[model samples]
Target: MDTTSVWRATAPKAALPSLQGDIATDVVIVGGGITGVTLALNLAEQGIPAVLLEARDAGFGSTGNSTGNLYETVSRGIHRIIDRWDKDVAHAVTVARREAVDQIERRVQKYGIGCGFRRCALYRYATSEEGKERVEKEYQGSLDAGLRVRWEPSLPPPFHPPHGQVMVLDNQAQFHPQAYVRELARQAAGHGCLIFEDSMVLEVDTDQRVVRTVRGKVSAKHIVLATHSPKGLHLVQAGMVVNREYGLATRIEKDGFPAGIFWGSGVDRISARELGVDDETYLICVGEEHKTGQEDANINLDRLEAAAAAHFHVRDIAFRWSAQNYAAADSLPYIGKDATGCFIATGFETDGLTWGTVAASIITDEIIGRDNLFAPLVKPSRFSPVKGAKGLVEENVAVLKSFIKDYVTDRPGIPLSQLMPGKGDIVKVAGESLAAYMDPNGNLLLVSPVCTHMKCKVHWNSVEKSWDCPCHGSRFAPDGTVIEGPATEPLQRHFLQDVE
Candidate 1:
């Protein structure tokens, strides 16, 4: 999805200039999103001189588009982790995540960030009877893992769990992710930390603990790759993360509605939250999770719109955006040293806001020579037998699919019969033709099949009805408006040619 409306709309102008000529600093932190900024702030508190650089503006990446759920619960199904990992490892992972959420709440109060943060309950509902049983089992596992949770029979609006089984975790919370990150940036800069915008890191020498960027280089005692995906120059960081996409958001009136965060299971995973800014209360609804960068596009938005209408009678969609993030197969993110002085923090799955904070805390502790309990659990190099085979199979399948999609398929055109009136099919649009799915009413929605930034074909996300870029994580609307980026430009429109 394009960044046209997602977090880009909420961005307050660039905070600093792009990296220019060469300069040196005590510590150079790459990526200015939530993870990097949070680390800088944490380091500042300890009187560490740090420098932050962004290829674009802060929050331009996954951090800006996040739904801002400070949740400890796993976004990837917990069942997968439990089945794949040892019980002790899974339990420790959950505890560390919960601790991270708690730490953010403390930071908000300690720094007076005032980012519209609120304590709320989060629910995961079972759509089918079988799913209900699954929820019950997971709820028990969570209890055994020492989490605060309750199993209920029903959920609030838009979702009636006929299975009568839902898992509710209290003290879970939500906030304006962009606002919170901006607050952290402000505090970091105030503490003598230097920030450089538009400074993309080109290389990293872990042996020397130096990061080289387009603008300059910084030699520090340690380096952190807080970039959403590890931008490895000489080392392999791919195993640390897997990327995925989320649906567009429509703003809704929050009146007489239960206040909190919500998600339901099915082919169409639905998520919603009641958000407020000043005097306005809006509902942010999202879903349609697919492997990051699938081939289908523009369908995710339709699913989101339908969910909104069914649940909230949504009158207007004030903001529409898409997001991509790395989800570690083992559940916990890779958050520790890579080489002598190099550190990495990726694959927070769907809860980067909380996970990013935890990453900062752990990495900061290591840099400062302090002992942190989470270090062992979130170690970057820890090997899991479960992730080895399953992850390998999944990755190979994805690569094979990409090959077939790139070399075999006749992309010049698709048949009209493949498209139902209400459903969209990707065809040539503007200069590029890709996935374009329709709604129940058969409105033609067009999007770029190729990602604006990385050229990987965007996938039509049926669950959410939006075009999702598999490479570099960009999303676009049916009309070609960007919802997220590594790509700043809106997708070129191509429906006119289709009509011709």
Candidate 2:
């Protein structure tokens, strides 16, 4: 039950040091994923002094845990964009995304990056008649979006016969996203951009343009909040829907599956692909999306494993992981300056690998005073309430209920003695409810259940062994340190007892 992703397990790490003292640069990127690393390289190529900081390692967030599929169309369907906006807008989105995928290929080739980048056709097929209309509309939408799409009679091996329509979009690509980010960081570092790992930003003073880490600080004229959900409170969080999707990999024979991104929709939605890491071939299947902190992660992962086994070969599971995604209210990512004047890029949904590169390109263009055609589409200032109303309303209402549930309802807590090893719960200790966990060695660690982001009650994620905030997707380790999301501060820690 190892939670590390296949990509992260195989890719080489990007070795970098943590920030020691205060440093100044023209631009400071606050994430080391594809967006921040690419932005750092973009700035360095332009002879601009910049610094990149990562909370953990490069691509440790959604980048490393992603499906590694890159295409013009999104998982939610291109028909969504067309229906929300217009044909022209959909075309623009596809054009911009295509360019981003091409940019990745260019970087891999130009720098001789060993990321296993390859061009392949994307197959979006329906598993049953219920999803026929979806694939049909997606095909039409792709054509409207100016993509070279065609109706295919069948899909490649390992995929069952399409029950409905099969849309094939050629020239789409896939790669080892973790390796790409690691190599991108190296390229940026070689070009004079300072890259720091294990330098989590504890504070960001947008007014003074300063980022503070545990040991040092960074001062820059411009700041880009590329961290998945930006590192603090913002207007965008209220409009975004946070969800976690599961991904798993299992061993497969050589050339067992076709080298392509195949998405099936019917009884369920799943993305399947094949990866050859060194001498072993692995089949990756990803699906089972659910709201973070709302659903049981263990159950969701179990469903994913069952579905993969049901549809594919009966190989034993090797790697399992999950990633969080924020879908914007307006159906587009917020990728520019907010009211706070600091640049923010979020709400990339599940297409972060491509949208992240687009964000870096747009942000870099703005910093260099260059006009980018796609900048206007994803600007943070744009308001599309009508188009984004469905998700915005649904998600905000859930947030409101979380507040009510935390305060109004009573949660039955268990005694510390009953809390088993490798288990956690809201335990009743000393007449107070505390977030408690018993380590494998029988150590009881306690923390406040209140979320530091907006005071929502934290729920235990049994699968990941962390406290997750239902309102804003903030997650904390068993020791209460922030893992991701908008919370910069760790959960308040409390000492209760040690089981001996």
Candidate 3:
């Protein structure tokens, strides 16, 4: 069972029926994940009649598989932001992130959604004395950005080489993101917003401001491409964003965990939190950030699980998942009108919860013809001579790599004859070794077969009876269980052998 897909586990049954004929609306939003749904909700609140098209069910992307912690700022490396984006831009991004958290909180209170919402602090600690300098530099950056942050020296365990320090910011929080988004979707539906699931958008007419899905076409005055990484824009060579992240939830038996959101300062940081599911205790572990299509996401999970075992007493493994975010090379989310009628809110990296909210507000503001505070920082068409050049080279290189590796090279496909009844194999399928297949009665079944989030080879975890993305920690069942995410899509089935 894939434990990585949060929407499958948390959200109510989605309203998905094949879209019939041509429909017209004032605005059409593609991608029903948090960004898309939240954008729709924002627009509805402003009395706009918009229709949302989701490739799958709502909250089926990072929102479903999130650790649900709304870390309002860059927890990884602030220096990276300064390197790619201007100081003012970085500062505005931070403020926008905080505003995202505030928006979520406000919506929760307004709708009375029961999603385990809480106000907590986020801690970023350094592993070594050298790392302490980096942490302090970030602290100073926070201050220089007019945000006061507290520095704590001599932290407890999990801080290897303990001579280093830590930084903590208050008022950060987390929750069951699926439940929260479901409520948002319900409210949006009540407020005159239409959401259609299982509607994969195949094309977009930026010139005409029209969106075409597998079933029907939608003609609208404006369009919002909030599909995490801009799925449809790739055909146009306008560029799309991609980044990979991992998360895990473990059953903890230990006491005195210090109950707050915790993270590290290294490139592959680790975050831990106490999560409640029924009567059991689960510690949500997250980190292992990297560019999408850059590396095997499972590697991050191994590193984080090792850290979790070292730091906390585990009773059992409850769930593990991964998420991918679109990181613009400029280190800012693309949240504005691109052409005349098309708007986008992507490249948010891993801060989508906050940035998604920012995107929603800005996109709504754009539709309403109001001045948006985030306009200056999140311009979609903004060009950065240095970052844009580097990002273009890097992203295009990845696109070329994926195209060559995933598409053109067709070798001997996985032999379904090798699969036996009631057995599964991580054999070479889909031209990649990470794909898996199983047979209940001698039939070749193709599920997501591969982890779409980071192209990590998913392992058939027999113990869990699920396809586990060992790299970034996403899990799905032999029957294609989307228990976790970053991967909103399921293990697509390619039946190779017939059951006899």
Candidate 4:
């Protein structure tokens, strides 16, 4: 199976250039994922000039690796929002999510973006008694949130038909995420927005309203931190729990394959959707989530492959990829101006496809001096101390435990001869910890094991072949380039001859 995402493999390459020198705009957006690109498009459409800076190419990050399902319900469940806040907030959340989906549809049509966007039904099924109860509670909560859901006694074949009850939510959508986002960047550029790729923002001066990169600086009237986790605000990082989830696409037989999204409840909740490329069809299955750097990536991949094999007629695994998500302690995304006055959007969990659009809408409204209806509910600075207290403590405790354990633990100290090609591990070299990897050509590469974000030790992700930070989900390539992050810097490179 290919390690690349199907979307990335199939989507067209983005051709945007990097930032050259100092530039100024009405707004500066510091990411090029769905949120940043969408926010750029929204602002540009409103006749606002903005500059978008991407560390890498557009959609190269989580947006490219995402499973591409759009849903109105939050990843943790709608009931969690009801329990934390009130029914009104939960209902408002649902409404806002639906609006985000509709906005995507409208933009695709209006811009003539051929991203294979399609509306499909979503089925949430239960496989166990606990799952059944959870589904029932979610069903009621969904209805209370003004969603139209129908109860199904059984799902069709190729799914757990008679084993569990199903709740079907209609009019949800999916698309080629990378394709859509790239088109969004193009459309934003067409509207006179400056789009830059490979332009990393090294620092943000909130007081001066300026962002600086190695090559240039952007002074803006407003700024939006659309990075996966907001680097501009430290508190936003602390309030989120990072998760790593795996996905695989398998070629499927045409006859029994389902046409809509299917989700199963329980601890090992699984989601499946079908995609068509040319005349061939493939089933994309994603699940087996764990805290970032907590579980073995190979194990998660195996579980997903096993599940896909058991449920459907799989010809072969076409693609395998993984994405990271950050869930807020309060079950809602922080999507407005933070205490520092810079607009931010993060903690989207698995529903970023929709919430990213919602963030764009809300941020654009704020930039254009209009009031957004959902801004107050999702404002970044707003906190529910009592309602989110337990989750905040639990998530932070996990972070602390991981930080201390990685900091104190000794490395395995495996020699370069013992390391296998296409794999990496942490080792002790010259009385210092180093991340070591052997390239396919038998060349040894070493870098500092400490994550640049918070100095936490980074563990090697075998499946993805990268060093992943446990504390905050920072990832780096074996060559020490920053892949994804709350961290902005690459791992420090170490010379092989320096080894003991």
lDDT of each: 0.68, 0.90, 0.67, 0.85
**Which regions of candidate 3 fall more than 4 Å away from where they truly are?**
5-21, 128-130, 154-163, 213-216, 234-241, 253-256, 290-300, 399-441, 445-500
Candidate 3, residues 371-428, lDDT tens digits: the string is: 9777866677677768666767776776665555544673234454576666666555
TM-score of 3: 0.79
Model 1 spans > 4 angstroms off? 1-14, 157-162, 205-210, 233-243, 339-341, 408-500
Candidate 4 structure quality by residue, lDDT tens digits, 385-486 = 887787688789888888667755654567556788877987766667689998889888899888899887888898888899888888889988887877
* lDDT tens digits by residue: candidate 2, 346-410: 99999999999999999999999999998999998888889999988989998988888877786
What TM-score do all the candidates reach, one by one?
A: 0.79, 0.98, 0.79, 0.95
Candidate 4 contains a number of clashing pairs equal to 0
- What lDDT score goes with residue 430 in model 1? 42
Flag the better candidate by lDDT, 2 or 4.
2
Task: For candidate 1, write residues 124-243 as lDDT tens digits.
Answer: 876555566666777876776667888777776555544666789898888777777877888888888887777766666777777776557777766777876565431223343345
Q: Which stretches of candidate 4 lie over 4 Å from their true place?
A: 254-256, 409-412, 415-417
TM-score of 1: 0.79
